[model samples]
Target: MGLWTVAAMTAGAVGAVALVPVALGAVGFTSAGIAAGSWAASMMSSAAAANGGGVAAGSLVAVLQSAGAAGISTATTAGLASAGAGVGAVAGRLIK
Candidate 1:
């Protein structure tokens, strides 16, 4: 009803809106990274094969897997942090 209440409500709304994008951005970024890693691995494997280097594609596979796990972990961390921020914002508005 007052200016302080209106400001708090607006901030809470902004925080809520931001939470979704923060999560979606993490997902989108991770997907792009995995796709790029897969593409690079494929290209490297082909190049090695062409050069008669008997490329061990398995190493690339391992690297890709590791990258994927790390991406997921990072996304999860970001998502949790975003959730915490959202909760804090709501709690702050409510308490005030």
Candidate 2:
């Protein structure tokens, strides 16, 4: 409820939102593609296996792949921002 808490929450929220793309990229999810032998590739493999050798549409792996290949949609971005804000608020409270 204080100034510092609000600032911390804002910063945390912004940081979480910004870091998502970078984190995805770092784990081999990029505009290019899922890098071979990378974590993304592994996830794809597992998802495919779980779905009888095919990655089902709308699955987590599929969604992430889509986001990586293209970019996150507005809805997804909004969801991420909300999650980020929630985490930020928690962090702010804890820090205080």
**lDDT: which candidate is best?**
2
TM-score of each: 0.28, 0.87
- Give the whole-model CA lDDT for all candidates, comma-separated: 0.51, 0.82
**Every model: Cα RMSD to truth:** 10.3, 1.4
Model 2 lDDT, full chain set = 0.82
Candidate 1 lDDT by residue in tens digits, 1-96: 455555555565556555543443343323344344445446555756776865455665444444444533556545555665566556666776
Model 1 Cα displacement at 47 (Å)?
37
What is the overall TM-score of model 2 with all chains considered together? 0.87
Q: What ranges in model 2 sit over 4 Å off?
A: none
